[model samples]
Target: MAADHVDHHEHHPHGLAHQFEDMAQQKESVLLGMWSFLITEVLFFSGYFLTYLVYRTQYPVAFAEGSHELDITMGAFNTVVLILSSLTMAMAVHKSHEGSKNGTLGYLIATFILGGVFLCVKYVEYSAKFEHGLVPGLAWHPHGEHSPQLALFFSLYFGMTGMHALHMIIGAGLLIWLLVKTAKGTYTAEYNAPIEVFGLYWHFVDIVWIFLFPLLYLLGRH
Candidate 1:
């Protein structure tokens, strides 16, 4: 009976993994694995950015026009939204680390809500683009000499922003899971590895948008 009780308490107190003997080791391992995954993601996003640079250099006039079609106000607003979400996510991790279950849950909820707002803004932007016939291979009708180049620009535009939106969607879902777990008191000061890992992921997603905004929406505004 004592052994079973001890095992139950150990899991709660430390949240150890079968492969690790202690919480510290598990946290380090989990962070290493997450950082490795994030490094791969950075490379993946870099490929898209490189593509953008190549095509923009190849067709600066067309790129400028294409960038002008984007609503700078909306893009800037979403940028602020995402930045705020990252802040809240950081706070959530801090609260979780402090072992304040309600604080963690509140901040997670705030992060989740901010993420939803970003998606909603994205939806509006995409709808506006579709209405303007900005999409390629479906409704694009260029009014200038750079029609083909504009098509290429919009193609990369949709692809990159679309990929980023997908990441936000996934991140929001993960926040929901974290919110539930935090509410259940699954995370404590000693075992908040998952919260910390998810926080890093959230911050990464927002950083991608920070770059995307300037490239896609602010490039030709001047």
Candidate 2:
């Protein structure tokens, strides 16, 4: 009987760890770690954005032409998809807070599906560009004016968006892992650090897209 009690206590969410006095402390630590990581991500992407700004100012016409060639419809669709996923992710966190395990799992699944849809749209857009020889350094040619600057524009476009997509893939994988934990009944209202951390990551990805859409799609749309 004593052994069984110890086993149950070992698995108790409130038991947590020696380092954390309570679940709230654990959640706070996780949140701080995520913010630190995101700060580094911001610094990393800043280099690319600065480069884009420099070149866009130098060759405004070429940048405008290249931007116009992008499929704004697809970009807009992806933006919507990500925003919806962010909402679902936030709802999942809320469900966890309310101690609704099933609701949390459902929201996680919904967010994952939305993320998949966004990636599929991205694939279609990229493939279309490849077929049209719009890719940089590989059969790229400007039909109209500003042919030379098209390559530079394509370079920045692919680099920035490709990095963002990679981050999305990582975030989706993390959420899936969190969902698995949720299925195993590892979270409760008193202990949901994982869900909250995942929410922070989802929000960060959404914010990145908010900036990306305008810079890549709406450049000189006027």
Against the true structure, whose lDDT is highest? 1
In model 2, the Cα lDDT at residue 7 comes to 27
Each model's TM-score?
A: 0.93, 0.91
Instruction: List, residue by residue over 1-222, the lDDT tens digit for candidate 1.
Output: 455543433443457767676677788899999999999999999999999999988989999998898989899999999999999999988988899999999999999999999999999999998899889988887757888999999999999999999999999888888888888888988889999999999999999999999998888669
TM-score of 2: 0.91
lDDT for residue 133 in candidate 2, whole number 0-100: 82
**Model 2 over residues 1-222: C-alpha lDDT tens digits?**
455532233443653877665566777788899999889999999999999999999999899888898999999999999999999999999999999999999999999999999999999999998988888887675666677788888889899989999999998889888989999998988888788888888888889889989998997887
C-alpha lDDT (0 to 100) for residue 146 of candidate 1: 85
For model 2, the superposed segments whose C-alpha errors exceed 4 Å read 1-15
Deviation from truth (RMSD, Å), model 1: 4.7
- Candidate 2, residue 187: Cα displacement in angstroms equals 0.8
Q: How close to the true structure is residue 2 of candidate 1, measured as C-alpha lDDT? A: 54
What's model 1's lDDT at 87? Answer: 95
